[model samples]
Structures are given as C-alpha cells and as structure tokens.
Target: MTSFSAAQRSRVTMLDVAERAGVSKASVSRFIGDDRALLSDAIALRIEQAIDALGYRPNQMARGLKRGRTRLIGMLVADIRNPYSIAVMHGVETACRQHGYNLVVCNTDRDDEQERQHLAALRAYNIEGLIVNTLGHHLEQLLELQREMPLVLVDRKVDALHSDLVGLDNPLAVRMALEHLEQQGYRDILLVSEVADGTSSRVERLHSFQSQVSLRKDLRGAIQETGPDLHTRLQAFLAQDGAGPKALFCANGIAALACTKALRELGCRLFEDIGLIALDDLDWYPLVGSGITALAQPTQAIGTSAFDCLLKRLRGDTSPTRSLDFAPQLLIRGSTQPL
Candidate 1:
C-alpha cells in the first residue's frame, strides 16, 4: 500500500512517478527531458506508464531552477501591427503553455535599435530559448545568445546563423499565387510588396515573381514597393495598356491592404477593372470589397513549430538542425475573378 493518502497521489510530482516506477529521479528526468534518446526502450516505457498511472506532472518552474533553465521562451517580433505577426504570436503562446513554458514577446516595430534593446532584455531574463521574427541587425548579440541557448528563426533569415527555421514555404506560395493568376486569365501582373528591408520572406517572394514571369513567356510581371508614392505608381500601372487582363499580386497582407487602398483612391472597380490576390490572409479578407483571394500561410503552425524546435533543443536533443517549411492553403475568393 502507498504510504501517502489519495490526496497526496492527486498532487503527483516527479518524485511520485519515480518512486512508483521503482526508478531513480535522474532516470525519470531523462525520460521526460530532451535526453530521452539516452534511455532504453524498456525504461522509457516504464517511466511513461508510471507517469500515466500517477497522473504526475513535472513542476517545470521548480525543475528549471534546479537545472538552470527558467522555462521561459523569448520571441522578437518585427512588426506587431502586421496581422501575420499577431496570428503567429497567438500560436506561439498556445504551444508554450501546452508544453509548460511561458513566452515573453518583444515587438521591435521593425526598428533596429529596438531589436537590440529587446535582445538584451531577453538575455537579462535568462530565457532558455528564443524565436526571432525580426531582421537580425545585431549579429554580435544574437551570436552571443545562441552560444548559451537554442534559437529558432521565423519568417526572416539571419546570415551565418545555422539554427532551426520555421516558416512558410515561400517558393511554393509564390508559385501558387502566380498559377492562380494565370488560370484566371491575368497576363500582366503587378507584384506589390513592402520594402524588402532585408527580410528574407519579402526578398524570396520578389525573386520568385521575377522567375515565374521569365518562365511564362506570355506573361509580363512588374514590381512595386508600398510607400508614400504607392498611389502614383499604381495609377501608372492601371493606365498602362497591357496584352491581357491585369491583376495585382500582393506579396503579403500589408501589401494587399495598401494596394486595395490605392485602388479605392483611384476609384477603380475591384476585380472588375483590376484583379487581386494576396499572401497571408487576415480575418478582414472576406469583409473587403468582393473579398480578397489569398494564398494563406499557416501562421499558427509556423509559430508553434518554431517553439517546438526550441523546446527540443532545450530538452537536450542535439541532432541536426531542422528546417520546417509549411505549405500555404489557397483560398480562392471573388477577388481573383476574371474580368
């Protein structure tokens, strides 16, 4: 018979699981921690069964203190105003809580100085892992942190940092958007994006658009960045006489919003005078005029995967660095219709 009451069993701990499994605390820890690969199958099964039976949960806060891990994960966001960032952050927070970790998110607002300051603040808190979504301008600080903990990059790629990456499959997404445009009988395509700002995602999308246009001899593609002059540039595109139907392909949600506003200002009919499809669908996509067709990135999945990559490293799984690229789901809406 167990010495403790049923009440004690209800408040099960790692010690309870270890005792019930007839194993040492170290062995039980190895089973739950990142070093489970070191344990034999039989031992692993025993520990799992014991945990299940006792309903034991690891007190990560207490355990982290003992192991010098704070069970805190840090995320650096470039533009919190961007819908994509907000959606991804929600996913990260959900996954962190599920895995007994807490998230400390810092929004740099796409500023380099703020990025540096946030990185320093995250380090001060001794975060066990980091998931970054900003342009990694401060290389020295990033490199220093990577030495002590795991880092996973999302959406943007930092040069010379060989860490796990969790992001959308940009090439595939670009291809999908182009193909949809072509199918809808759009020949002249204007790919509008925000300024590259050294962001890998934007750069890749731009490059992909150029490449796609090159391969499709019948199609002509032009590039424009959203800025104060977006209205002027878009007006010129609308006036230009092209071979066939002209459509605006927004590289992401921000670009879509900007281009849509420009079209509104020009008093151009949506999808009647110009067709449009954008990347990274926001909730307001359907509410827009005739709805905006989109190649929607699995933002939540990308965020959750980034945290999972960091968690694996924190748990001591020192295997090859992983790159998780999720595919987009094409949501065909009225915006991509032919004239």
Candidate 2:
C-alpha cells in the first residue's frame, strides 16, 4: 500500500471529487447545495459518494469568492420579542429551506445604529439578499442597500425605499375591530397603541382609528399613545369617567395585555364594566378572564409571500416593486360583549 505525502493529501479539491466520481466539478457543487435546475439521481448519488469518500467539504468561502454569490439571505428584525415577528420569521425560514437558501438573522431592537451594523455585516458576508423588518427610521440606509442587493421589507415599511414590502393591512384590521365593537352597542371607545411615531403599523392603525371614528358622530373615540404608562393611564381613564369608554380597542397584543392588567388591578370585571378588543390575537386569548376579541393576521401567508417576493427579485424578474398587504380576521369573543 502507498500513502500520499502531506502536500498531496492537502491538495484534494472539487476537481479530485469530479475525477473520482466521473462527473464534473459543477455537478459536485450543485450536489452539495442542491440548488441547481435539476440533477439525475445516479449523478447526485455519485457526487455524494465521492464527497463522503474523499472527506471533501464544500469550500463555501472559496466558492463565494470565485462566483461572487454567497447564497445567504440576511433577515433583520426590529424586535425578536414580538410574536408577530417570530411568526413571520418561521415563514421566511420555511421558504428559505425549501429553496436551498441559508438565512442569517439579526435583531436590531429598533435601533438605527444596530440596524446599520447588521446591514454592514450582511454586506461583508456577501449575502445574496435581505429581508428587513425595519424601524422605519433608516430610509437612506435601506435605499442604499436595496441598490446593491435584492431587498424585501416585511411587517414594516421604510418610506423612501422603493422595494418589495409585505405587511398587515393595519387600517382595515382596526376598522374591523371598530365595526365589531360598534355592533355590540359600544359608543365611546378608547384606542391604545405603543408610543412610536415612525413604525408604519402603529401610525396606520392610529390614523385609521381616528379617520373611521370621526365619520360617526355617535361613536366617540380617542387615540392614546402610551408605553410604560399604558396601565397607569388606562386605570386613570377608567376611574374618572361616567361609565369609562364602553369598549377599549387595544392596537396590538402588548396594549391588550396592559389593558387587561389595569382592569384587573382596578377590580373592573371585563364584559361587566367595559368591553375589550385587541388587534393581534394572543395565545392566552381563550384563557383570559373573558376570552378577548382580536383580529388575527395571516402570519404564515405573510412569511411565504415575503420569501417569494425576495426570490423573484433575486432571480432578476423585477417588473415592478410589489407591496403586499394581508388582512386580519376578526375573532368575536366574550371580552367585547356585555355580561
């Protein structure tokens, strides 16, 4: 038996795999990631055997450097703590897996500086595309990135960046909640949302509430921007009023939880003292004091569509930048009805 020298042993490459398997280096490359148009089972098996026999690992860095394509997609989220973002991520990941693409995720915590850092790092990695759930403050940066790579905005929108975007139809969803609450004979309603001026979801939901409520003289509603003070303000509102707003329309899950806490703390029984309705449905919706009425967004569809849009852009099939918005389903429950 003859053993190869150290240098000879180290010199094995994709060419060696091709030679051993009686196939082309291109076949071996395609077999590793399996991203090519198609491959016959026999040819794929040969490549796999050669790779295993030669202890050959695909040199992803070398391939990226040579081809100038990383085959990586970067996903930036404003906050990982949000369930809605997580659901969208699951959609993105599912699509990426099916298409043989790798995803790198970054949490920006809605910070502009962190967002810039993540964008720069993804660029450094030579990522092929990007999916951004942005803070809506970095339009220039996002626009610049979009110019260089295929970009898709998810769940949030940056005003100046003319790119593919997928998000919930916030105004319409809020209107659904408002209409339902009105049907329950709730005249005075209070809309509560997070205190963020630039976030597209919050802004749109607030504006929609104001516009829709203003048209009906009998329906009195006021939008309150709150963060940490959400519970305190809600408690104060409930204490001072004649019969506190007949229904509390929470803009999102966070606000919904705050409203629930405030009501419980004040010993105000839901469905007895006031009605409750929330924008995004929660896991605990059914188990709460009274099941909360909510508008549930189509998270899976949002994610799948976002990936499809990104793939279309990556393939250079850009006819026009598409902005896809999904509507929410209103779930009626005891929280919004009088006991």
Candidate 3:
C-alpha cells in the first residue's frame, strides 16, 4: 500500500472513492444522488464506508449545477461603505440563509467601469437572481442579465429595465420630512444630496421637494450637491438674513455625513446656527451636538422583500413587474428643534 500526505488526501476524488469501494463510478454517483434508493443495501454500504474512510466530500456547486440550480443570489451595491447598504445587505443575507441560498455581493464604488466588470463576473457564475443597489450605469449588461435571471432593484431604478423595484416611497418620504421640518419651524430649507447622476430615487426626492416647496407660500427651499464647494456654499446660505430660521434636509446617509462635515468646517453651531434633518438614520446620529432628526427607511424589510421577489421569479413566477415601495419612520431629535 502507498502512503499519501494530508494534501493528497484532501485531493481525493469520486473516482478514488469508487476505486476504494471496488465499485464503478456510476454506482458511486447513484449512491450519492437522487437515485440513492435504486442502490442495493450492500453496494450503498460499501460506498458509504469508502467515503468515510477517505474523508471524501462531494462538490456541492457541481451537484447544484447539474440540477440547474446554483442556489446563489448576487447583489450589486453602488457603495458598500454606505451604512444603508450594509443594513440592507444584512437583511438580504438573513433571508437567503433562511431559504437555503447564498449571497454574492459586489461593490462597484460608484464607478461605471467597475460596475460593468462586476456584472460580467456575476453572470459568469450563473447566479440564480440579482439585487441591484447601483447606479445601473451599465444598462446593456443589466438588460442582458435581466433576460437571464430576475432582477430586483433596491433604492434606485434603472430606466427601461422594467423589473421589480424595492425601495422607499420617495414622494411620500420627502413629504414626511418636509412636514416634520415645517412643524419644527424650519421654513428655510436646503436639500443636500449626492449628484443625481440619473439615479431615480434622488430625482424623485428632488422633484417632490421642489413641488412641495412651490405649494407652500411660507416655505423657502433650495438644493445643493455634496462636493468641494459645499463648505463655501454653506457659508453663503448661512449668511443670508431672510427666509426665517434655516434647516438642512440631507437626501441620504452619505449626504447627511458630508453636509454635517461641511457645517462643522464652516464653524456653525449644530442646531443653533442651522437645524438638520436627514434621511437614513445612522448610528452616530445621536452623538452630534444635538441629535440629528432622520427619516429612517425600513432597510431590513426592503432587503427581505427584494429577496422574496427574486425567489418568486426563480419559482416560475411570470406575473407582471412589481414595484414595492416602503415607508420611512420619522425619528425626531434635537437637530430639528425650533431655534
């Protein structure tokens, strides 16, 4: 008999198991697959004994592929560092585990080239479905993927994709935020957001804010993008005397953090110089001079629902496309207090 190292033992294959059992490879396959019941007790016992003796484990990916199911779900996130993405991904992962599927997440860092690369890699893996929280810059690739598998869009919608969508009701959420600010005596408002870049959610929020501000005679509102000029812009906005006490409506968590930093840089007293209300309640919201008021999206529920939509499609669901819009809960803090 020949001796084998641990590495050699780990490389043991099905053929090795069959040779050890003194049986054919087909017999071994039958013993391990759906045809197990077809194997006689004597042959099945030999195969089992050989497998245990050799510490053999079947390749689950290969087995799954043979059954036309890899049991893997893919998720593409625009920015993984965003707290909102992290929270939502947690929910998606939990749902996947419950349903005996695995999640493969790819972060594009908001780059079109990276987005295309990730999409290509995910397609090569034959993922069962896709959850997109990206800018959808690579529309051609996305459309192709949609043809191959069901896609669920999160937080943002791609034009002409016509797939399922899971996100906050942007119009209603913006309305709620504005209503809260107005109730707190914040009449002069600035909507701070990341550059729209054709992202559907941002556009929706911006349009809603504009429409609502126009409807109210007492309220004054303007929009700003978070960038290098943000600090200078903040200074100008703060210096203006009219429009009553002012407040900042941050469009999302990333924008909230950026605007807060700009405010700090401009030496403004938090909530005293300018009030702040932001979408997406981050963990550090309460630690600021005055806690930041926020419209918190149901991230976990949204993620779970996205997966549920994908599951339905995988199970032969041919229903019309769906749009699942969730609501946000307002959490009042010192940031939106009347000054």
Question: TM-score per candidate, in order?
Answer: 0.81, 0.85, 0.91
Q: What is the C-alpha lDDT profile of model 3 across 99-140, one tens digit per residue?
A: 999999999999989999999999988899999999897889
Model 1 residue 6 distance off true place after TM-score fit, in angstroms: 34
Error of 3 at 86 (Å): 1.7
Clashes of each: 1, 0, 0
On lDDT, the candidate that comes out on top is 3
- lDDT of prediction 3: 0.91
Cα distance off (Å), candidate 3, residue 80:
1.3
Q: Tens digit of lDDT per residue, candidate 1, span 1-339?
A: 235556765598778888888888899999888899998898889899988777676766676777897879999999898899999999999999999889999999988899999999999888889999988989899999999999999988997888998898888998898888998899999999999988998899899889988999878999999999999999999898996899999998899999988899899998899999999888889988889998998988988888888888987999998788999999999998865
Q: lDDT (0-100) at residue 324 of candidate 2?
A: 91
Clashing pairs in 1: 34-315
Q: Report residue 173 deviation for candidate 2 (angstroms).
A: 1.1
lDDT per prediction?
0.89, 0.82, 0.91
Tell me the lDDT of model 2 at 275. 88
Model number with the top TM-score: 3
Considering lDDT, where higher is better, how would the candidates rank from best to worst?
Answer: 3, 1, 2
Error of 3 at 155 (Å): 1.5
* Candidates' RMSD to native: 7.6, 4.3, 2.8
